[model samples]
Target: MARPNLTRPNATRPDAAGPNAAGPNVHRVQPGASVQAAVDAAHPGDVVELAAGNYPGSVTIATDGVTLRGQGNRSVLVPDPADHSACAAAGNGLCVTGVADDRGMPVRPVSGAVVESLAVAGFAKNGIAAAVTDKLTVHQVASHDNGLQGISVEMSTRTVLTENEARDNGQAGIFVANWFDRKGGALETRGTQVAANRLTGNRIGLQLRRVRDLTATGNLASGNCGGIFVVGDDGVPRAGSLSIANNVVRANNRYCEPNPRLDSVQGTGILLTGTEDVVVSENLITDHSGTSPMSGGIVLYPSVVGAPNARAVVTDNILADNLPVDLADLDQRNGSSFMTNSCRTSQPAGHC
Candidate 1:
């Protein structure tokens, strides 16, 4: 889809020298100014061009419609270089602290926002968080080395997250949670797209929970606890759909003793529990090795955290070298089919 070239009320677009053509209302964020201050000064359709510098603070954005494009992805929203020692001391000091886990004030709510071309690191928590918002687009951003997820979208609809890099997070790289308390308690997630991103060195590359009608395509996931984990909460998973294609999942270490226990180090390349009617197809899954017998290329079981035994579909995936097993722990109540999967040296023809 083509984006408009309009400027936000107070925000400015980049100039001739920057990545995108200079829009009329672009603003330049200097070294000393606070990130919050720059956000405050920005209006809808504005672009905040950040120069290379160390900014020590968090920013909360309330603008409903705007574009925040950084000068360059890597140099723009990086951690404060001055705080390197403190960051190392603090452990995983990248961007804002507590961006996920129902904490922190959001720079941009999950609704009606657009953020692109920014490098966000050292967040004590998530690099970017979206909750209960709609029609948000996050593109060309780099989120890494945070305490929690690189980016989290919770209870939002019609959101597009594309061409982003989520890596080295202490927890899951990207988590899409669509659980919200509406009138009389209901859950809904419509049309969420996660595409063309690189996720590596996290607990889980992408976690989808309590939502459906989603698409995850053209992504690369490696060196994490799990490549992709889809789960439901409390009860049987609803009748929703998830499509994953053209992605690479590999080398997920189940026992990442560095953080320990906070994540499921003994996890799977793709785990489906209490999640039904999902699809895993045309993806490359390889080199999944862990100490536990339950760890496999794809794992389907009841929940260790919540309820269990849901239906799912696992088909047409290249499963190779998944150590200990290829597929394991199918729930007795689970309703699914595993067909056309290429297993490597596993028993029962892909059954563990």
Candidate 2:
């Protein structure tokens, strides 16, 4: 679902900003007025331009090089899933709060931000919620049914959520978080770039909480329940380099989650619990089976008994019929490193 360009060109804003001399570059958005009043009357290298249809509310892009484009999927914004009071104070529907704004006083962040080709749906929360962000950019948007995430980046840096279209979101359909730094020790989202997205039916179709230098490539996480979840909520150590390559991760545990800690991540397909130097390569990760016998296709949930030192390297992926085993490893992770994975089955026995 590519080619819906909105004048692209936001490769994580390498110095972005254009049209100088105090004003005008492209600030359309004029029919009846709104879209945060044209982003509070544009400024730094402006370019508001939203003129297709339903733009109900929530919009916040505290100007930097702002470029909230539209008119691709006929520009829709929906919000009002209970009124976020019009977003950006704490609420979000399209809030790219980068470079600053963290409630009480923290300032200076909104760097070259850009949200393109709009279509963000019903959001009571995230449908694009960039946090202490950096050079942000979310292109070809189509974030659907969101009461929560459909693109939520926290503590962001070098952010670049590409070719977007995260579906049915109630939480995670492309989420890259990190933060922890009050007393929780360090951890701040390092250079990130979850590319070529299309994560389906949400609940964890591309997460990466407690992130670190990441680069989840060519995504296509299917049916979501656990298509690509990499956690480490707060063991500190700021996670590690995660480079999940060439993705296609399918049939992710299709909906269980009545909340037994999210029903142990339903029907998995790439669940790396206590994140570490991860790198599940050359993906095609297949259809995860249901009814939770720890449904799978790449489960490496280590990190409690002894903690910290949880590595991963399931290489050359193409994993087949994902059920109770397509490559399991629940804590046998003593520096984990499964070889040439073309998975059928593999546990604490032999690298496979």
Candidate 3:
């Protein structure tokens, strides 16, 4: 399927007055009120405007074209242990779920759902989680201190996650995956974008796993165990066809213990594994120094499942002060090349 235009119109702004503004179509909820009730009662193209206060409990959005807007970061959403809503029960602060198959793959994605200008923190799982949603826009939200991901999108396409602040999360600040619990071939994201976000103090700043046809650009990632990770596996269709460009990734030197899926990670910047046809260009990766095997600038390692990267293009990046080497092509897969990168050192001796 062709990708939809991900831009939002001015009329969709929180202050905009339209047929759905400040009336029956717009549902305003105060701090103690139920956000879920307004969400449930909303029709398509309606706005659920939240007042500037702390809202407890979790809410779920299943309806299409619903805009959940808040008064900037002053509107905060926190966990309510006593609230047994499905979103809270699942340990997510806010969830947008759509029709899925028995295997948990999206069959019919929720369309035109927006979540913006709010803060969500201290959730056991993700701050904001979306599964099987298309053209889902999450912007200007502050997601921090979540147990899992700050913002997670899975089995979805055409997602726009821009201008968000994600920090101090246990896992990736922003995570995009085909499926979290299952193994499969890479899904085609059809122009999903992760752009212009500030990410710090997470295990990994950003992670793109088992997905293709995506772009991650103009972001700042620092102070994490790893800056960015593009991971694929032995699954068919293999993750690739993506662009990682024009980003600043630096000083990801925090030490994170080995998890069930990965070894101890620290001081890594832009690690790409088991992917094909990926472009890593115009990024400033610097000041990452650690003893871990994965530590370096633009390191390409084999995937966890031992699949090697192929046909990757590493070009036009400014790399400096990375430990072990600036560019380490540990995979040395076929048809991969490094050219025109301004870096001091590399494992193979002459790629720089």
Instruction: Please state every model's RMSD to the true fold in angstroms.
Output: 5.9, 16.2, 3.9
Question: Model 2, range 1-352, lDDT digits (tens) per residue?
Answer: 1221335422222222455444435666643457776676666666777778887778888777668888877988875554445463344678877554444223566776788888888776688787775778888899889877888877667778888898998888888765422223224555677888898988788877666777889989888877887767345664657788888988886765565343456788887766677888898988788765456888776443334336678788888887867888867845768778776677765655
| Backbone clashes (count) for model 3 | 0
Tens digit per residue, CA lDDT, model 3, 261-280: 78789999999998999999
- Clash counts per candidate, in order, are 25, 7, 0
Give model 2's TM-score versus the native structure: 0.37
Full-model lDDT for every candidate: 0.65, 0.72, 0.90
TM-score of each: 0.79, 0.37, 0.94
Worst 10 residues of 3 by lDDT: 1-10
Better of 1 and 2 by TM-score: 1
lDDT of 1 by residue, 17-124 (tens): 222344435567776775555555665555565676655545455565545666556444545545444333443322222122443223344346677777778777
On lDDT, the candidate that comes out on top is 3
Q: Could you tell me how far off, in angstroms, the CA of residue 245 lies in candidate 1 after the best superposition?
A: 2.3
Arrange candidates by lDDT, highest first: which order?
A: 3, 2, 1
